[model samples]
Target: MHAIALTDGLPILDARSLVDVDLPQPQPGPHDVLVEVRAASVNPVDVKQRAASPTLRSPRVLGFDGAGVVRAVGDGVTLFAPGDEVWWAGQLDRQGSDADLQLVDERIIGAKPLSLGFAQAAALPLTTITAWESLFDKLALTDVSHGALLVMGATGGVGSILLQLVRELLPGVRTVATASSDDKREWVRSLGAAATANHHGDLVGDVLSAEPEGVDWIFSAHSAGRAADFARVLKPFGAVVSIDSARELDLDALKPKSLSWHWEYMFTRPVQRTPDMVKQHELLDAVAGLVDSGRVTSTVQTVLHGWDAATFREAHWLVETGRTVGKVVVER
Candidate 1:
């Protein structure tokens, strides 16, 4: 099997940061499926993992979002079989989807959207799961009749899909999203956001101007240095959910409003071996149905046409630029 791997947590600028390597084929464990990867997408988690550790005794593969076909399955796997097309964000604790073949638990894998190609489907799983969990799971937003929600970093991967889900699931809710420019604002609107705020300008004021009473919920893609802004724009008793790590957030700011804070890590179910881990598969299938119905669209902004080390490295560079509109996918 061929894979792009890292032996050290070097900067992307270093030539040795990511390298092409040949590895033995991986075999499936109980409940696992061996997938032949056709396409994968780069996320911030991949970048963070590459730069988090100084050195590794063994090569570490680092792609999470992928679309592929199952070549084999563990004896216990009942959800899928050899020759089944699948998509998923593989567990963080396991070898990721960067390899030509990866062993992923069938519980986390979903049928790929039939309406989409491999690259388009590859760009969705991680972001879709994160966004879906943030809204329906963490926020318990399945029944709200009418309210305003704000999404920070709305043009990014997770935020892009999140807006679409809001439109599809909670039609009564109005969404206010944060975008830095005119183009990004329009882009977010196309995905179903009712309003846009400039993250660079007065974010609190911008959101407040859209909804006079403040938003009912805030979904933040990047929460660093924006806790105060989030606190100011959320109504009393409103909740805020974030996917990024925030070490120095002032919990006190949210105290006055009785605001609740939550962290939505999509890997929680697979990493913790939660009893409901199969929810990922269910949500993914639901999203695929929406895609097939033409109610949603793939968020792939840029596609790298290859399945090699150089292409993967270039995908990382695009994601690291912090200005990518949606996702950067690499496909064969």
Candidate 2:
């Protein structure tokens, strides 16, 4: 199997930083399934991982979200068969989805949404998992009868799905979306945001102008370093869920308002080998059901040809630029 890998360069941003390698097809563990990867999608984590840890041992394949047909199943795998079309986000500690063949635990896999193609399905798992877990599991926000929800980076992959998920799951809640460009603001508006704000300037004023009472929930999908930025716009006793990395956050700033903030990492379940690891699979299936029922739509905005390092570099570049409206995918 041919795979794209990070072989050299300290902060790799191009094909020179990655290479093509031929490796034997990976065999599955007792509870794993071997997938013939048809298409794969890029995420912000891929960009972050490739540029970190300067020294590469031999080579490291990079990808997490993939959609493909099951080519083989381990003896202990019962949920998926050899011919089932599935979509999943692979474990972070193992080889990734940037290969012709990849092995993933059956417990974390789900049947692909029937309404979407392979490329479209590939774009959903990772971001959908993050968004679903952030809003529902981590924050425990299934109902929006209380107040509005604000998403930071509203045009990104996770935010795009987050906006729609909130609309479908909580029809009565108002939504405030923030984007950097006019096109992005319009995109989120189409996704059913009650209002859109420019992340670049006067975001709080814009949000307040849209919702005078203040937002009840804030989901920061992008840079989450600043606290004062949204403090005035958020209601007292509000809650926040952030998925992005933050180097510095003043937790004390929320004391006066008694605001509660939570951080969500989508890989935590599989990474920690938790007892509820299978929840990811179930949640993914639920998301698929939502997609199939016409309550959700694919967020893939750019689809490139051939799953190779060159094509992946383009996707990585787009993600790093922080300007892409939605997910980018490539087919093998």
Question: Tens digit of lDDT per residue, candidate 1, span 115-228?
Answer: 999999999999999999999999988755589999998999999999999999898889999999888988999999999898889888899899989999999987988878
Cα lDDT of candidate 2 equals 0.87
State in Å the error of residue 317, model 2.
Answer: 1.4
Report every candidate's CA lDDT: 0.92, 0.87
Model 2 steric clash pairs: none
TM-scores, all candidates, are: 0.98, 0.97
lDDT of each residue in 23-100, candidate 2, tens digit only: 888998898999999999999899888877476778888899999999999999889999999999998999999999
In terms of TM-score, how similar is model 1 to the real structure?
A: 0.98
Off by over 4 Å in 2: 9-14
- Cα RMSD to the true fold for all candidates: 0.9, 1.3
On the 0 to 100 scale, the lDDT of residue 208 in model 1 is 89
How displaced is residue 276 in candidate 1, in Å?
0.7
Q: Which ranges of candidate 1 are over 4 A from the true structure?
A: none
Could you tell me the TM-score of candidate 2?
0.97
Candidate 2, residue 222: CA error in Å?
2.9
